[model samples]
Every structure is written in structure tokens, then in C-alpha cells.
Target: MVDRQYTAWRLYTVLRVRSQDWGGSIVVHQGMDNDGMALAVAANLCGAVFLGLEPDPAQARVVMRAGFCDFLVNTLDEALRAMKNEVRKHRPLTVILEGDAAAHRAEMKERGVYPQLQVIREGEEPIPTGRVEELSAMLATADAAHSLLAMVVTANSNAELRGADRAIAEIIPEGDPRRAWATGAPKFFVREQPPRRYVWLDDPELEAMLAVLPAGLTIEPLSHSAY
Candidate 1:
């Protein structure tokens, strides 16, 4: 069953890559979170392979436990060396990178290692300041069913909200049944009622988001657990 799922995912990845310039070996630089692992699995399921470059042994173990083929490398340099070998072997079309993984990609680009390496940002793309008002206006028109609205707040305001976030938000608030906001990262929906908010922090979903958005952006998951 898992193998069949993997095959389907690989086909999906190929299609996605063909549609855009993004596809191939996805390297999850961040530790394996539920969302992160799901992304890795999705890529593999679709035939796209993944390499999780985690520094901490404990964290790396966690990722491995999640069914990811992970490596214990601390620095981007070390990770790059390993990743390059994988790239040569797999010859993947896209690479999914997070945190320091992106740094490695930048360095490789400078050294001319993988010139085609496209770096996807983490969170949603920035809604144009011109469009913030438009978004606000749209939100205002939302009814009880449209109460749930997905808002992407980044440390950097200039960044764009990810395509996934935008897409999720668009379909969530049509007729105003129950509000649900979707974004690349899980976020606490400010709505006060049953079915609170669905914040997807799973790696698979994030990877799906990454596959769609090839630029690094910070994605913060909204949770009641105050971290």
C-alpha cells in the first residue's frame, strides 16, 4: 500500500515539476515535524525522493523514525556534500529546502554546483499593500460561515503569502458556513467556536506548499500551546 502511494506521489511530483520549474530531490533541512514528514512522504509517494538533513542526532533519529532517509550533518557544507551525491544518484528535478538547507543552496549556487536549484520560500507570499485593503474588504464581507480567515503574518512584511495559503483561504470562505483558514504553516484561527481552526503544520502539506512556492519564507504554526 505504501509503495503504491509512493508511486502516485512521484507521478504527482513529476506533473507538478513539469507544470512549473520545481521538481526533483527535496531536501528537508528542518527537523521532521508532522507536516514536514508528510511533505517528504508525499514527494516520495509521488516518486520524488527526499533527504532530511538534520543536525542533531536525536532529531535525526526522529526523522528516520518518521520514514525519512535522514543524515546527521550539522553544517550546510557537510549537508551539501551529502546532498550533491544524492542529487547525482537521483537526478531529481526539484529540491525542497528549509532553514539552513536554503543557505546550502545559496552557497552551491555561488560555487556553481547545482545552477538549477530553485529555493522555495517557507510561508505565504506577501499580499501587496495595495491588496491588503482588498483582502480586508473581502474579509469584511465574510459571513458566519466565512468567519475563518487565513492571515499570514511574517517577520518580514514584504514577503508574499505562499500559493497554498492563498488557495486555501480563497476556497474556505465562500458562502460562510464555518470559517477555515489554510496556510503553509499551522496558525491559530482567531475564530471563537466549535471546529476552531485547522492549522496544517505537517511536513507533507508544507512540502506541497513548498513544491508550489520556490522561495524561502518563515512559516509559524498557530497553536494553543504557548511556545
Candidate 2:
């Protein structure tokens, strides 16, 4: 029964990828071996073009046969030249939901009906419409800047959040002997850096350490603990 269920899931996933219109995009697989070859074959079967970056001549030949790759480039330069003329699709839209939408999202996710829907669940009270507008404005402002940095604060050292490029784990209290060694590395990283836009993430208490960062940084809160 478990095997059957797993097979059903795989079929559903293939169908989902196949249904998408990948007209002006190229799926670039770094190495054309193992899962890389699998992705190339799947993308080709879905009528999508792929670029396999495999240096091995023998392996490249194998993968090329498995799929109709636009460019089986061996180097970054070759890949760039191949993709230089291809047009790309615009960024996709993101749907942000609050309140009772959780149940509906869960149902779709469980049934693999809307496999492309990516959800970010925040356990805090629903954000006000005005606040949402404010956040949108802030995001747009940041987007216009040269660069934007995101920091995620969590108890789990290995915990990774999507869209967060950096992670702050275990905010030790003052006078704790381990505090020095625990946060020492991240200190150099956050201190005295060039002026840049920054955003804080997760637990409020733990993320307060950002306050100590250099005054030149424009730090703002993005979200609270989902717990």
C-alpha cells in the first residue's frame, strides 16, 4: 500500500510539472549525473528545454540522448552563449493568505492538487490590511535598492527558512560563558558592514540581537514566530 501511494505521488508530480507552460525558460542542471539526468529527462518529456552542464563527454552524450537539450555546454561561457538569445518569462505571482485559508491550503496540499502553491504559515494574529500595504511598500522600496539582506533567528542551528540568506541560531543571554564562543562568528559577520537594507525574522526575543548591529544598517521586522 505504501509503495502504491508513493507511485501515485510520483505520477501526480510528473503531471504537475508537465502541465506548466515552460515556453521561454531553460531548466539548467549542474551535473548531468544521477538526479541531474532524471531532471533533464523529465523536463524534456514535459516539452521544456534544458541545459546540462556536464564536463564528461561520455555522460553528456548519454544525457543528450535522454533529452532534447538546447545546449550541452561543458563550461559556463558556453552555457551563457547558448542562453544569450533565449527570452525568459516574467516572475510568477505570489498569493499571500490569512485567516481561514489554512484549511483550504492544507486540503490542496494533501491531495497534491496544487503542487505549485508555496505557503508560508505565520502563527501570529492576522496582519491588518494597512500593515500588508505597508509591508508591500517596504518590499518595493527594498527591491529598488542595490542589495537586500535577510536574517532568520531560530533555536535550531540547522533550521533553514526559504528566502532567508543568513541564519542566527541560539541567542545566548549576557554573561553566559558560552555566549562568546556561540555568537562570536556571526558577530564579525554583522558588525561594521557597509550600509545595506536588512530584515529580521522569527522569534521576537531571540531576534532582538539585531539591535546591536551597526547604526548604518536599515533593519526592519519581516515576521514573527509561527509557533
Candidate 3:
């Protein structure tokens, strides 16, 4: 998933690089070779492909679109074949997930996906994105910004509702997401972004983002979580 920590404007800056210009970009489902697959696709000018453990089309589309490229999808079997073909020339896959580079290297070897793993350096190349891919990235970016801004709105305007969760606990339920926010949690229907991997802003950051919004511009709550 595109890093949720990216502010909307920042993500838009990242999204400006279209895959058609770079040839292609990868959207991995569960691993980095998927990015290698993207490299292969870009190198060979092939359409992006997606694979996963889940069968939900909605979820799969979300996973793939994060690469910000046009896609060519199929069954896992087909994806594997395509991946092999696309990734072979691009050995020692480029890993995009953010983490300690050494740990990512160790894990990739443990999984034996790519013995020739090479963590991309800051200057190696920015991950390439496409116009279609921008939609997913933009939405995730804007939604993340919204998540931060909403919390401030909820806290300031709904002070009476603070600590009132217990009264509504039965209606809301334990372990329910809403319970997490003492200030009526902003119900973000996270669809494309991976759960919890994206931005969760601190109060200071939220205050700043909220500050820039036009006065009285309301951010409405969704009735339910987005699937």
C-alpha cells in the first residue's frame, strides 16, 4: 500500500510520475517480488498484474491500483507465470515497503523469494506511477488527511460526547473501531489503503491540517466504514 503517512499534497507530488513514461510500475499483493514484477512490466512495457491469497475483487483492485499503473490481471496461476516471465530479466528485485533495509533483506531471504534482494536507495528511482494509479493514491492520500482533520473536529465540537463511549458501548461494541476514538472516531471507510499502514497523525499535525481548511467547511462523517 502507498504509505498512509503521506499528506495529500505530498502524495500528489509522488503520483506525478506516470508508468507510461517509465514503462511500468508494480502493485504487489503480499511481497516485494511483486514489485520486481512491476520492474519487469516496466522494463518490458507489459501491463501490471496482481495476485493474492484473497478472492475479493474489490480488495484485489485496491491492492493492484496502489502501483498507479494500468494492469493485466488473472488467476494466481496466470499471475505466477506472468511474474516469472516479467521478473526474470529484472533479478534482485527492488523492494518498496518501508522498513529497516537489513530486516527486509533478511526476511526476503528467509522466504526465498529473491536471493538477490537489493533495497532501493533514496536516489535509485522514485517508484513509478500512472494516471489510473493516481486515483487510488490520491484517494488514500486525501482520506489520510481527512482522518487527521476529522479527529480534531470531533474532539472540539463533540466535547460532550467525550468519554461517553461507555454509554454507547453496547451500540458500538467492544473492539469496534469507533471505541478507539474517545471523540466519536471518524468513521473512515478504508477501502484501498492497507489497514493501519497509512498515516495516523499526531494532535499537532492534525491541528495544522485543520487550520488550513476554510472556516466552517464541514467534513461529514460516513454512516459506516468503507469496505
Candidate 4:
């Protein structure tokens, strides 16, 4: 048990606390682009496993290179099956859902598969299209302070990037004393767009979910958190 704990901690430090922390195991929606890649990298640095689901072979190639376990499937059903199998096999400590995961969560509950699984939806409509430039400018301002700010900006740029509605500008305040430069705040941002939503699984909650699995079944932490 001690060895396992130490290993887990080691993995966390390597993937999450190191300078290149990407965070933890993540289950991403396959259509995510370069911006999404940046976010996944960040998450992976933080100690997370990145599971990418996409029907497009080309897109899967991109995700696979980024430490993602690719699932080549067409319909939502196929995607769900692949995800379930991965979850069962890995018993991951966390599951960060992107894209059509909410639907899968619903289906899982209805079928009494992981009936206790809860899906929290975090999304909002795209800020009026006209606001894109305004948001872009804010990102530029934030970027001057922290390079990760640029990644946030890119992640929330559009549906093509990650299907996110919000942008980096919305989260970090300009000229704030707590800016990354001054206080080194964690890079946090989310998209509130419908259909394409982001879900963050807390560590404890994920652990509990995994504990329910039978013995001999264990999940590994894919990424770690820097702070």
C-alpha cells in the first residue's frame, strides 16, 4: 500500500507539479484542435491521463501523439462504449469530460451503468460574435503576463478549437495584483457553450468512483497538478 501511494505521488509530481505539469487524466472530445491540444498538454502536465474520442482518423492521430488513448468510433454510442471500456480498464482517478460526454453520462445513468455517476455541465452560449475581438484583446493583455494565458485564449477561441463559449479574458483580470506574473495563479478557464461542455472531476470524487470497482481493478493518475 505504501509503495502504491508513493508511486501515485511520484506520478502526480511528475505530471502535475513539475514545471511542465499538464494536470491529470482527461477524457477529451475528439474534435478539439490546436488550442485543445494546448489545454490537454497543460492538463497532462498536472498529472492526468488524456483519453481522446474522435471519429476522424486524422484528428485521432493528433490526439494520440499528445498522450491520448484514441478511440476511433463514429456514432455517440461507439464513443461511449470505448470510453466505458477505458474507464473500466484504467479505473482512472479522474475523468475530465469534453464534447459529448454529458450525453454519455446520461446514457450511463439510464442504463444503471455507473448509476451513481454524476455529470456536471459547465457551459454558456458563445459571447456575441462581435465580442470575439474584444476577448482576443483581453487575452493579449493577459498573455503579456503569463504564456499559459495565451493557451487559455486559444482554448476558448471557438468551437473549432474546443467548442468553448467563454474565453481566457473572462477569467483573468487585467492588471490584477493576483495575475500570474505577480502571484502565479493557476491557469484556469472554461467554455460554457451548449453541446460542447467542459467537465472537471475533483480528485476525491474520482477516487471514490474508482474505489467502487472490484479488487484487482485499479486506475492510474494520468497527469498531476503543479500547485
Considering every candidate listed, which one attains the maximal TM-score?
Answer: 1
Better of 1 and 2 by TM-score: 1
Model 2, which residues run further than 4 Å from truth?
1-19, 65-70, 88-227
Better of 1 and 4 by lDDT: 1
Model 1, global lDDT: 0.36
Highest lDDT scorer: 1
Candidate 4 lDDT over residue span 55-131, tens digit each: 34566565555443334444445545555644445433222234454454445446644312111113422211211
* Candidate 3: clashing pairs of residues: 4-198, 4-199, 5-199, 68-133, 189-226
Tell me the lDDT of model 4 at 211: 48
Candidate 3: where is the Cα deviation over 4 Å?
1-53, 63-74, 91-227
- lDDT values for all models: 0.36, 0.33, 0.32, 0.32
Candidate 1 Cα outliers beyond 4 Å, as residue runs: 1-31, 46-58, 91-227
- Alpha-carbon deviation at 63 in model 3, angstroms: 4.6
- What's the CA error at residue 220 for candidate 2, in Å? 57
Task: Give each model a TM-score.
Answer: 0.34, 0.29, 0.22, 0.29
> Which window of 10 residues has the lowest lDDT sum in candidate 4?
126-135
lDDT of 2 by residue, 1-227 (tens): 12211121222233233344544444433344544443443333333444444545776666455432444544334444544344243221111111223343343335433222111113422211111112123223332232223332222121222112132224444543222223322321221123221232335633455654333333444342211
Write the residue-wise lDDT of candidate 1 on 1-227 in tens digits. Answer: 12222222222333233333223444332334433444454444333435443334666566554434445455556556656655656543223333454455455446654322121224423211111112222222322222222222332222233343464455444532111223312222122122122232335544454455425444444322110
